[model samples]
Target: MRQTFHTSGPVLMGDQTNSQEFHLSLEQITQAPADCTLRYLDFHGTQAKLGVEYSGTAPFTRDGIKLSPAPEQAAPLQASWCVTLLSPSASLAQLQQLMRFFDGQQWTLVAADTLAQRPECTVIRFQIEGDLNFDRARLSCLRVADQLGADLVIQAAATQRVPALAGFDMDSTLIDAEVIDELAKITGIGDQVTAITQATMAGDMDFCESFKRRMALLKGFSEKRLAEIAQELPLKEGAYELLTALRALGCKTALLSGGFTYFAEFLRRERLPLDFTYANELKFAEGALTGEVVEPIIDGDRKRKLLTEIAEKLNISLERVVAMGDGANDIPMLNLGELGIAIHPKPKVRMQAPQAINLFGLDAALYLFGLNDRQIEKLG
Candidate 1:
């Protein structure tokens, strides 16, 4: 059977176009066509031209903007995945390239929305579906994104809803500086301690051993100095804004750090609206470091356990949890949450994380929840 369509302007089909009207078979509108193309106005009202190919079983459409078959004849499966691209230099040309990449992979671009747009950064979310090999597709998308100087996050649309519990790592994730490294600087052992910190974070050395060694170096370091550093800890850009938005959404938030409790607690009490803070305790004697940490260090395994415990205590399912961090020790919890994001992580951590944000600050994470800038501003 054939379907007829009339348009005020041009109706593009393959290499041909009609100024007033056109006709297409049901198969052509419902099924992908090899060596053909469709040009249509996208939901954003921009002209999008996509190459189409025959895929006997797959449904294809670009934001429901394409000429479609009758509702009863449309394919059952719609978009099943959500891919968000964020960059400081995102442009229309880059987005078109991404659409082409999707088309080449046999994935349909179901919809595209700009979540945030500004000169400094642009965030766009693409809803897509196909026989996706999730990992392979993510890696492919990331490669393309790298070429475009963008950060990409791909997730199942089912689990892309706003999380009920959001967990974050402290050092280098929420804060601009690592507390231990900063303390090391104040103690005049910055070089030695920073080396261990870097190795531990990069997953080269054991976090426990590194912590012990670094703490021993700070033995006899005065509490006054620690307090001074805590009071001035630099927050990562957009940390406050992100946390504020989460609070407005009534989401339970936690600072799940492998750093010290003193610093983490300081952030909770004075800065962010965090519901819980978990970290190691430094044993203090006579207001000086005893060079010993409290037992049961919050290593990678511990962080994961703590995240699970928090979810249980709040009666929230793991699928509704979002975990973000930047170190090797944060890997366990990152993988535990339904949405795991590595924030400016080391090379190793980034490779293992489900998603990453490197080009922008923590606030960019909001876009991953399918939120737009207007929604975020409303939350504030």
Candidate 2:
């Protein structure tokens, strides 16, 4: 459908003829990347603060105002893409930066407008002037979107668990951070520590190597910090609701990760089944880190092995298990479950995950299990 957007106001979608114009927000559009091609970005027709541009044979121009001809389209001899500021997740200033990178690349583009609300995510749509080289630009666009977290559009769904066992990533998966990493945070090395955290999550680095490097960075870190961070790490959205609902349905609930125990300690305190939390250990020197890890990094392989063991012990079949994760490390388990769920996962992880929960929150995972909001509230 044709939509009209304004630089100062909101973008109008659906029936633009109507006086009732829906405004999109930067927030919705900026849910960031969903690890897919044109999934949902924000709720469809939702207002977004979008900075849109066109790059096809007919630069998306209406009355001389250019619009990007959708996401993927052919240009001329030079490959180009229609870059849009779908939302302000990255901000107008950020879009400008992207433009600067795109500038003088022998590419032509027209920045038509900006709007307020986020929009639905969709696969690439093109109105190419003609088929031309556009692969480079498209790839660049994907990378920009990923780096900015302006890569996805959230969809709509029910917030509840279906009747089934729910698997969780223990570290950042359930709570946050490895016990050792949290300990490092107390010593004021959080930024360095989190760097390893991100790489491990992104699947850019090897799990054990990454874990050890981050662990080594934590030398002189204290065990006390583990207890402290455990008490403070934020819970993923709907984590509690998910656990409660799953248990109510007699579904198995488990926490598996390549993280550590200190953070799991928090969930354990919460009194959730947690079922099982697997990860490596951080040895402490009296109170601080000893700059060494206990043998056998739990890594991805171990996580899968542990899942197998847990399934066997519980007398549950892998087909009945549901796995969720955000990084490639979790892929093994995600593939192991009957229904592997990717929760706000990275691009690679999402593409491989059997099912994805892009709407609502973690509670949305409950929906696939057959639980609804009302049912969940009843459980509460």
Candidate 2, 49-102: lDDT as tens digits: 233322222111222222223222111121122333332232333444444544
User: Across residues 246-294, which tens digit of lDDT does each residue of candidate 1 receive?
Assistant: 9898889999888999999999999888999999998999999999988
Relative to the unseen true structure, what is the C-alpha lDDT of residue 9 in candidate 2, on a scale of 0 to 100?
Answer: 18
The TM-score measured for candidate 2 stands at 0.57
In model 1, the number of clashes is 7
Residue 36 CA error for candidate 2 (Å)? 27
RMSD of 2: 12.8
Predictions in order: lDDT: 0.74, 0.51
What is the model-wide C-alpha lDDT for candidate 1?
Answer: 0.74
Q: Highest TM-score, which number? A: 1
